[model samples]
Target: MIVGGQLVDEPSATSPGTFVSVDNGVPLSATNPAGSGDWTGWSITRSLIDGLPALFARNAATGALY
Candidate 1:
């Protein structure tokens, strides 16, 4: 998937190579009702935001882009 003209991918539940992956629209936080590390429906991208390289992701379930 793509966000803000940047390229993204949902290759697997957890990152194929590194880091944490949360489910689409599923909140991953200390106080999340669904707990943590349980959601994995996210579209992730490594790109430039505000002219700086950053990692971006979208929550498929909630339409949250961050």
Candidate 2:
């Protein structure tokens, strides 16, 4: 996930989820629960498959893109 413009590792139940400070929208420390917490820090800024340019052709019988 993303936090304050940087990527962060997944969070656990005990460890607070990725979150940002509402005051300035900065990534708050996992230890700090006073700030916005348990927030999903994901953004679709670009296409992940853009680098892998390819065309998948499915079999005539199969309707799946392969």
Candidate 3:
């Protein structure tokens, strides 16, 4: 799916990828959440946000990321 003009692919469950849900609407994420590997917080991406897996749920009424 396309968010914030960026491209994201829900290729698989084990490798569902990553995404950031901004309260005000900004998107940044990974293509593989499970294999995101080691990190040191040097990345300038959004933190404390829910990342959707290949199999995810969304609220239809508000289009909220759940």
Best by lDDT: 1
lDDT (Cα, 0-100) at 53 in candidate 1:
88
Better of 1 and 3 by lDDT: 1
Question: TM-scores of the models, in the given order?
Answer: 0.36, 0.21, 0.18
Over 1-66, each residue of candidate 1 has an lDDT whose tens digit, in order, gives: 443333334345464665334334232332222333333565666887899989765667887776
Assess each prediction's global lDDT (C-alpha) against the native. Answer: 0.49, 0.37, 0.35
lDDT of model 1 at position 51: 94
lDDT tens readout by residue for model 2, 1-66: 445534344434444754443443444334212233332332323333768644332323323333
What are the per-model C-alpha RMSD values against the true structure? 10.9, 15.8, 15.6
- On lDDT, who's better, 1 or 2? 1
| Model 3 lDDT per residue over 13-45, tens place | 343464333333433353323233221222223
The model with the greatest TM-score is 1
Off by over 4 Å in 2: 14-66
- Candidate 1: residue 8 lDDT (0-100): 33
The CA-based lDDT of model 2 is what?
0.37
